[model samples]
Target: MRRLAVLLLTAFTAALTLTSTAGAHWHPKPTTAAWQWQLQGKIDLAIEADVYEVDGFEVPAKTVSALHRKGRRAICYLDVGSWESYRPDADRFPESVLGRAYAGYPDERWLDIRRIDILAPILRSRFDRCRRKGFDAIEPDNIAGYENKTGFPLTAPDQLRFNRWVAREVHRRGMAVALKNDPEQVGQLVGRFDFAIVEECFAYEECGKFSPFVGAGKAVFVAEYSEPLAAICDQAERLRFSVIHKDYDLFARPWEPCFP
Candidate 1:
């Protein structure tokens, strides 16, 4: 009986240790990390970057393996706030939860985020695909639907609840999660998200709002469509943001990185 008790205690200690160690894998993005966003076309294994955010579904495991082999971090981009007609599981979403069409994206429609019970499982399955593909992090885009014409009557509190849930689940899976846009909630979300992924913040004069993330020692990755590198590079460098200039299509092509 004494020996059995000792073995059980040892097993409990081992389990506790493993749990703590697993949680520590949630690494924050580097302050000056170089990142490439290539959501379409063939995977460009030759891009110069420390991190690459690609489509969670389109990218295969082998491509993620190749990126890992090069000591590069792969971030899976998943749409959590909007339902697109192109996804493999598009039919899985019922019409009741689907809202108005996303601007400029005729096939995509905003989601009724209040239906977390229904959407959470779908997002978990999508994120699980990313996890199984060995992605080091997740860039959940279209997360700022509350600030848009989502047609769901979504309020700031509702967005907060969903975004926080996203961050919690991502961290629970031992993967880093970034806050995409939604600069208005930066202060509230900085504590929950691992980093900030901003687009056109400089152009919109919202770049300064991301200071909370940087101040919290979390990375802020900014992507601009038309801003000249010289125009924002210095300002971005001063803010320690990993800035990149890419085309709207996000085609696999050469991109300028302002990583110092």
Candidate 2:
């Protein structure tokens, strides 16, 4: 009986140690990557890239499988900060959590990040769906809603806390997460996210702000909608970012790749 008790205690200790180790390095950040974001259809799969970003819930599992077969990683794009009217789970959000319309998107409303206790579970369900669909990573959009007129008096700290929770939750599911935009917080968050996807950073002259990601050996995938293609391409190559020019819709439109 004494020997059996010792063995059980040893096993319990091992389990705790393993859990702690996983919590420390479970979400190993990506070192290098090239990715394509297409919220439209499967044509993105044919774009000859190392990674493809597809609509989180709308993409079929077969698409992820196909990307895997081709030695590519698949990322699921989810909007965790805004309530889209077209999403199937749109009604799941309570009225209290919904705020003013997202600045340019009339159909979408910013979510009150302060209601994280209530929102986390809903986001978990969405991330679970992404995992079930076999996505290798996640691209959470609208993370900077706090910087906008969200109608909730959101602070930078509020955005940072919510973004950190998002990173933790995604890592808990064994999937990598990328920090979208919110360039102001890049210095504080570059270590938390695996990679980054930025829009018009060059146009805004903020590309240098995100260089820490590449300095840490993680890839920065950028898309510019309005910059002169030639000028942006030059800067993109110089910065070592996987840069492309696409329309605002992010459909299968003409793309100007900066690298090769």
Candidate 3:
């Protein structure tokens, strides 16, 4: 019995070690990297992008595997801070956690981020699916709910705690996570998140707020909808941001890379 106990203890220790080391999977935080963000139409595989950010639930595992075969990384796009009515797991969210309707998005509603106990398990399940699909990183959207009218009386500290928990959960699953469009909290979050994804930063004149990410050797992926590439490419080049002119719909076409 003593010998058997020793063997089980050794196995348990090794299992724990493996789980801890999983977060050590190194994801490079390049200042500039070619990337594609397509969430609406069929994915175009010939975009010549180094990274592909796609909807986590809609995309198949085989697609992520294919990106890996092509020497490209895949970032799983999941809305951690909102509940989309169209999602497969939409019904899992209780009414209490649903807040105001997401501005401009008819099918989405902001989540009561203060309910971490209720939200963490659901978010973890989403993260697990992404991991199983072989995504190298995650793009968690709507993280800056406090800055918006989420109808939950959310404070900045509440947002920080939720965001940090998100980072920790994603890292624990061995995938890098991006801080999506939360420029105000970048200073506090840059050290935790591996990269960032922002939309119309140049148009909003908030591009400079993300300099901390570049300074920390982290990539900042920006998508400009109204601004022409010619107008922002110079500043993008100077800032070392991976900027692209993408339509708000996020189809494969209308993609104009600043670096290209």
The C-alpha RMSD of each candidate to the native structure, in angstroms, is 3.0, 3.4, 1.9
Q: Summarize candidate 2's per-residue lDDT along 1-260 as a digit string, tens digits.
A: 99999999999998787566436532323333345778875556567667678898888898889889998888899999999999999989999999999877898999999889999889999998998998888899999987798889999999999999999888777788899999999999988898888999988999999899888878788888888767876667677788877889888666666654
Q: Against the true structure, candidate 2 has what lDDT?
A: 0.83
Note the clash tally of each candidate. Answer: 0, 0, 0
lDDT of residue 177 for candidate 3: 90
Over 4 Å off, model 2: 1-34
Q: Is candidate 1 or candidate 3 better by lDDT?
A: 3
lDDT assessment of candidate 3 = 0.90
lDDT of 1 by residue, 1-260 (tens): 99999999999998787577447755665476578999889988888888888999999999999999999888899999999899999998999889999999999999998899999889999878988999988998888888889888999999999999998788767688999999999989998888889998988989999988888988998889988888988888788899998999897775888763
- Ten residues in a row with the worst lDDT in model 3? 25-34
- Runs in model 1 lying further than 4 Å from the true structure: 1-22
Instruction: Give the better candidate number (1 or 3) by TM-score.
Output: 3
* Model 1 residue 83 CA deviation in Å: 0.3
User: Measured by TM-score, how close is model 3 to the native structure?
Assistant: 0.94
Q: List the global CA lDDT of all models.
A: 0.87, 0.83, 0.90
